[model samples]
Target: MSGKKEFGTTADGKQASLYTIRRGTCEADLTDFGASLVAFRTEDRDGRLTDVVLGYDDVRGYEEGDASMGGSVGRNANRIDGASFSLNGKTFCLDRNEGENNLHSGWNRYEKRIWKTEGVSADGTSITFSLYSPDGDQGFPGNLVISVTYSFPEEGALQLLWRAQADQDTVCNPTNHSYFNLNGQGSGTDICGHQVQIFAEQFIPVRKGGIPTGEQAEVEGTPFDFRAPKEIGADIERADEQLQLTGGYDHNYVLAEKQDRMRRAAVVFAPKTGLRMEVITDEPGLQFYTGNFLKKQKGKAGAVYDFRSGFAMETQYFPNAVNLPQFAQPVLRAGGAFESATVYRFSRVLP
Candidate 1:
């Protein structure tokens, strides 16, 4: 498979560019708009290649803002309580959309802007996309230069490497918002059959608006326990107040020392298909969002995506970190480089 297929014209009805990177059976198509992934075709257990990612085939869908898709979330991913923070002894106010909380940089989100793209393959299995965020853009104090690398090697690992330098001090919490379904897109109605195991003994509980309550509790004997492989829907319908507040699983699980860095944070396996995926990241936390907001959208092959049809296990710094000094710090320094890596290794177990 190749990513050379035509995407579409530019947002202004002018010329458009398409970039592709292919290795073996893995191929991904990235268009200029929002630096989005138009197509990500990977092989399934039966050796069938499918576009497992949920996206709109037309460029207009991306311009119209239906889904975040495979775009890189930035400036800061997740929420920041009250849309305000105190840094350098000065108070900074941000655009608040989620009630009093700031969700994904509010009005100045990176998802809403186009990114400058360049196709680089020093080793042939990886392609890097780079963009520069101007100072004072998104109400942040920095002109940040960032790079995101997507690679698929023999290990079937998609390693996301972020390197950045701020012209001024700013917060850099970058993470890819790629939704996954190991059963393959359009193949079914839900990912409930897939089993998941997260390397987290405790998880940060969140309020109704998705902000942490500054309490990290153990997952033992609770539905949040994923130390062993369990169905995502096993405890999904529980009567827990936190679960009901978020509509589903939408909490950040605190990773163990090893799996939190230099190891896999979680592993998911589809017993029916033998497709196993392991997530390895340097980030301290992983957000488990069960697509609670996907309201019956059409996916590949005209298949409708119902709630929990797919899930996004995003690895990054804890949400609302700016407000909770007790949690891991999301702040970046002028001289220090901000780096976070997450790898998803996919392999087919023999029947």
Candidate 2:
């Protein structure tokens, strides 16, 4: 099923619409502003419906909120060291938003822009949103055209397809920054009881500013280890230095498989609701953040979101990838296409 509603109007007087897509037992509300996934509802083991992705009640909350709630992040998804990188022997300095480093494309964030509607699918299973980033926009070289498509299939999967093309060599790494709480959006419960398992044996270690230190450290025996299923809070408060530095699990995990191959990256299950979500991506790294910094923010149904209330499984290239030669390069060349897909497959786990 498919439908549309008037979300709100932008400050520039542009109108935004909230589109809804539905499949077998799933429904998603998407907005043109930021091309954000405003809400996603699925059934649990008892066939009880729950909204898994977090967000507010209306467009204004998204416009004035913390910005990243269920939004598409780009032109580079994660951090870039020192807010600059050398591409083709030229230094491209980006706007720094997180300390001395640039996080999620800084001030000119895609999450704050109004994307154009690119039409829905013939079967109403997908809604495509498009945006254009001019050359030198946010200090990045090249004129870039980006399209993010959110699709809902009949088999209980919410898939995201990201495609981009540039006129010059530029950085293009986009990911859906959707924080999820399987129990329910605005459920007022922390994700500590959620069980998480990442299909990675190693992770890129971070420095003081959340920049990768160019080291793919082993996850064995460390709190970073998630090769096996365990409670998200099991090792979160450990005395481990990495945990101490970031305050929780906020680092990038190196996928066990090689890069650019669509594969399973991680799985999260909320025992309370019997909701299971499996993340499949073609990207090489997964930023598993546990909502460590979320403050008391208002949410739907009069719920206030606090720390650990949600978590994000962001799939993309490593943080500061352009500066670290060892990391997978994030450069999209002239006339070349940058294509990637990530799927959040949902299901129920019965007692």
Candidate 3:
């Protein structure tokens, strides 16, 4: 069954609520504000329930945190070079929030807004949240209607499906920005010891300011290689150029050029808790970030989240795809619709 509770009001006094769906041993907590994932709990190997996704106890923490936490990001997730892009012979300039580029759709990103509850499943297995964006919002040329659904039907899995349609041709790429700590949120430690494996052979290299340099570098000999399971901190501290550029593991790994089919993207193992999370998605790229810049911020249950405490695997189209012709284009036509799905499977590693 599912339950709903009053989350809180937004800065503009818009009312918000949290919907929770439970199936077997898994439970997902989602809020209408930003269509964010508030918490995801799974039974550990010790038979203890643990909330694995990092988040706050209320809506105020999300508004005050630097990281997006568990919110949905869109209007072109990630960065756009120089905060500008050309489409149909017209150059569109976006609001620059990160240096000379646009990061996660700038200051007025979708994560800062409140979404409406669109629908719920008859069996209480899913909840859909939606928002409408006017044409020229965030300097993008389209009136877009977006919906994101969170579904929990099995004991150890949660699926996120995103859909968007526009009245005018525009850039549209959306992904969830949920920081994960399989050991559980507010656990007072980082994911440095978690072993991670990403099924990618090449990655998009970024220069200073976190903009892609247009080169698909091989991960053969660099610290970007995670082809096999390895501790997150093993090569994270290496004196590599890319590692230093982003201050940690913050780069986009290019999946094989597959079309419209869900594929395995990544797997993360938290040794201490014996929790394993497998990511599957139909997107073309995955942005792996090690939360390198996180500081001692307040979180759920009076938890002080410090640097490198959690990590994120954002599955979506490549960053700055609007400016790169060679990359997967994120442009949506007037009559076309965008649809993508990603799933996170949680299971306990038995001793």
Q: Best candidate, TM-score-wise?
A: 3
Model 2 backbone overlap count: 0
Task: Report clashes for each candidate as comma-separated counts.
Answer: 0, 0, 0
Candidate 2 structure quality by residue, lDDT tens digits, 272-303: 99999999999888999999988998987788
Q: For model 3, name the residue pairs that clash.
A: none
Candidate 2 local distance difference test against the native: 0.89
lDDT of 3 by residue, 91-119 (tens): 99999899999999988889888888988
lDDT digits (tens) for residues 1-351 of candidate 1: 324445566467844455666777677767666666666676667887766667666566665655566678888888988888777777778888779878878775676566666675754666667788987776777789887777775546667787888866788888877777877767775877789999989999887798889998889977789999999888989998888989888889997422234677899987766778888888888998888888777655577777887888888788888777777787788877887788877777775
- At residue 326, what lDDT does model 3 achieve? 89
Instruction: For residue 158, give model 2's deviation from the true position in Å.
Output: 0.7
Rate residue 233 of model 1 by lDDT.
83
| For model 1, the run of ten residues with the poorest summed lDDT | 1-10
- Give the poorly placed runs of model 2, Cα more than 4 Å off: 256-258
Q: Rate the local accuracy (lDDT) of all candidates.
A: 0.76, 0.89, 0.90
True-structure RMSD, every candidate:
2.3, 1.2, 1.0
Q: Candidate 2 at residue 246, lDDT?
A: 88
Q: After superposition, how far is residue 296 of candidate 3 from its true place, in Å?
A: 1.2
Which regions in candidate 1 have their CA more than 4 angstroms from the true location?
Answer: 1-5, 14-16, 256-260
